[model samples]
Target chain A: MVKTYVFGHKSPDSDSITSSLVMTNLEKELGNTEVQAYRLGNINKETEFILNYLDIDAPELLENIEDDANVILVDHNSPSESVENLENANILKVVDHHKLALKTSYPLFLRFEPVGCTETILCKLYEENNVEITKEMATLMLSAIISDTLLLKSPTTTEDDKKAVTKLSKIAEIDVEEYGLKMLKAGTDLSSFSIEEILALDAKQIDFKNVKSIVNQVNTASIPDVLEMKDELEEGMNKIIEKENLDLFMLLITDIVNSNSQVIALGKNADLVEKSYDIKLEDNMVLLEGVVSRKKQVVPIMTENA
Target chain B: MVKTYVFGHKSPDSDSITSSLVMTNLEKELGNTEVQAYRLGNINKETEFILNYLDIDAPELLENIEDDANVILVDHNSPSESVENLENANILKVVDHHKLALKTSYPLFLRFEPVGCTETILCKLYEENNVEITKEMATLMLSAIISDTLLLKSPTTTEDDKKAVTKLSKIAEIDVEEYGLKMLKAGTDLSSFSIEEILALDAKQIDFKNVKSIVNQVNTASIPDVLEMKDELEEGMNKIIEKENLDLFMLLITDIVNSNSQVIALGKNADLVEKSYDIKLEDNMVLLEGVVSRKKQVVPIMTENA
Candidate 1:
């Protein structure tokens, strides 16, 4: 039996979880192999809401895969964001929207589009393959598009994503104004998450020439609400910096409504953010107006500075 | 005007040089952007002979490319094999037969096959794109395949390569045995090359955990004839080990006619060859019964041992 595990990057977002399931279904519909959907971490609240709404069971949690396990990656190709021991796995296929940072010994199928979400690319694949999108799949895909594009407000949003959202919303019969806001608000609830959990919720590690750093982002309706917990977040970030021996740790608390961000930077290389944005990082805090997308705005600036 | 540079890895081989030209031709015929073929290094003797035979000009040499300069890679994908500053370039497409060891920031077209030669994959692409393969183009591509697969005798040779050879030979209108022997003989002439030049010819760097190594292979009809220069070769290898800070440096004097290899293992991890192949290294030399294909035989075993 040919078994292939399909998964996305760690710190599972809605796009990552939904795209894995969508890709597995499409692979099965093609009738080549036995593909199983998997998640690298606990599903976020927004993703949980979508899954519960569709009544689809969450994928199995995968901590580690074997060296030669046949796998298909979705949503991400960065080794930093992928599962541990990803370099050793036999990657069979990849469907992603992010920058490619993966290298394999052998060639495999890869379909990447510079869109907001992996599900947008999957939507095109589904159409090209003549696979019908079910109501539940449509709902989940639409949710992912909205989550990633921030209801088409993010810099990463593209014409392809807008097209996918419009078509998928019709199929899923969801009001864009009603369901998108509800879903985004669902993910903003930080009451249950500890400071540690919050730091790791959507964290990504990046390696610079001489420094290693972790950058985490959380979207909220009110960025000041998250800032109220800044002291606790800094404490948690410092503990993580010590544990991972990181050069820098950054937390970007983004306001979806205002399209601004409040950053809490810590660690030795925390000055990088200050230099990148030309702002004084007083008490490791800075408010940047009109900055939202991590991939478009934050990473490029930090990478240039680093 | 849109400009794209097409090239292969450093220490360029016949396949690397020829495939770049062939891919450029194919891309242009398909009516894409303006694509220019380039060589990462000077063309080898065998490639020069083939280019002269067809009266085709060798591609311009490229040392480095600007960040986001569009590039289409051939024969290789590893940053180690590609142009300097490859990580910064915007990779538009890749046509390779080697293991996938590339990561890009955005999605691009990639046509990769696990065949013995990159030209074998390019042959299919030309057909798929409905582009006419000229006579001179056919000769260069066939020369590349013969060089890489050793006239379809190397272990790395696949059915796809054999099929490509048969079809390409028809297009080029050449007697395979006569031309293949002449081409192979031309590359075996090391009379003018210094020890340093010989070591740099077709060398590949491999980074294993806790060790960095360089593997260089030279094909000859008589292994003993090449071994006569073993002392000079070892001295050169030691110099390279120090220069590159490598833990291991290996030189394979492959007897092409007999399909066997004599290895000159040097550096700190020279014992790895002994451990991997269950052989005792006398004066850091060992004769392997049949080890013509470095991709199929040497890399995997050495990687396992390392």
Candidate 2:
């Protein structure tokens, strides 16, 4: 039997990284032993914190897929968000919690739900298959839900996510409020990252109509501290815009405590940001009040306005 | 709340029509009262037989959807296979057993599995949500499974489909061999259909590497009887090919009992038929031994060769 590789979307986050691992475990429990978990990119600080706390190793980094390699995608389905040369790979299954954009030539196993995190759906899969959820797996699942839903505060959080978090937290035997805040704050510490690294932390490439753009978001307790690096961030964003020939680039610095975001918009179609939110961009930046989710609060609005 | 319409693909067959109705019932049981089922086209003979046997009415025909109509898709998801003006509609959910080609701007509920029929997955949904399946729904689901899987003999049939068939047959209080054979034979009775009607019975428009084509399949008990109308069928196919500016058109006349197909090739790239199967097209047709599934056996082979 040919081995199958499992991984998540590029610019790996807590949910993406953890879902890949959980899915791999589920597949193995279902008697598919020829599968291994991989990460599409480097793990962020929040994911690193959880892995260290649980004493779990990070999945190996995957740079490129061999031709006709069998792959199982978690957390995302679009080719744009996946690994390089994904078109050549044979996608055997997809477990995601995002909008549908993937196209395939054959029928495959796909499980998608409008929930906050991919782990929430994976938690259901574990139950449905009657597989035992170990402490490490429960911790991973709980942490991912907490990260994606921002401790059940984001608009994308659904009842399924809330239930999964409750069940997983009890099994993992962790204080949700205490541990969630520490992990989130650890990710917010950007002093060790360069301007480019910070920009690449959670950037997503999206095409709205013909306007190509990249939306990068970073969560912090104090938005003002991240905004202090406005000039350096703009230089890095412009460099990426020029290299990729993008129409727009938005950097959303979100305050996890207040649930608001300060955005820096740049590029030729930067006015689309102002048009979408009906707000003015002061010094190439604006405060989007009560906006935290890029998927719920940003992408759809930009797509409509574009 | 605005009413949401549920439907399947055009050229509605047993699985397509039955899945729409079953999904509507499942939604209603889940507390979604403002939902109704509709069929994209006229129900075929096999589905009509099942509906009449169960003393149920067929769903109303859906011609075109209004702008921004909320809809739930069943059995099929590709835009070309769905209703007109689908791009302007808001798709809330999809329950399918086909390839993933549908793209949405927002995250929604999608459940796709590699099964023989969409009803097989719908059966799991009913059990998962603890919804009771009435006798009518069970009969409809069982008939769809039998039709799509050819009484569990098709290569597309999976273990879940086999299990569903056994369970549903007991609930409906029907004999598997008796009712399945009757339904399968009812669909194969294509003598009442015209050459054009036979061609339109189950036509699917596909684009393979810019080679636009339509692949139509019709099941029959006697291949020679259908072959007697070869001249008229070829003329009608030519007219459609010219009108649609197609590169290829293939008509697969399958014998349900023998599990083989006789294909009629037409259009500019008709030689693709020979290229795909590595066989000569004698009199613009060839016998495809053991080819019963358009999805599993035909489309994938054509795609790889294209």
Best by lDDT: 2
Give candidate 2 regions above 4 Å deviation.
none
Best-matching candidate per TM-score: 2
Write out the backbone clash pairs for model 2: none
Worst 10 residues of 2 chain A by lDDT: A223-232
Sort candidate 2 into its docking category. high
lDDT of 1 by residue, B1-306 (tens): 578999988999999999888988888887865889999886778887898898889999997888878898888888888888888888887777766677654556666666899999888777755688889889989999999999999998999899999999999999988999899878888888899899998999986556699989998988888988988999999999999999999899988788899999999898999998999999999998889988889887877778
TM-score of every model versus the real structure? 0.79, 0.99
CAPRI grade, predicted model 1: acceptable
- Native RMSD of candidate 1 (Å): 4.8
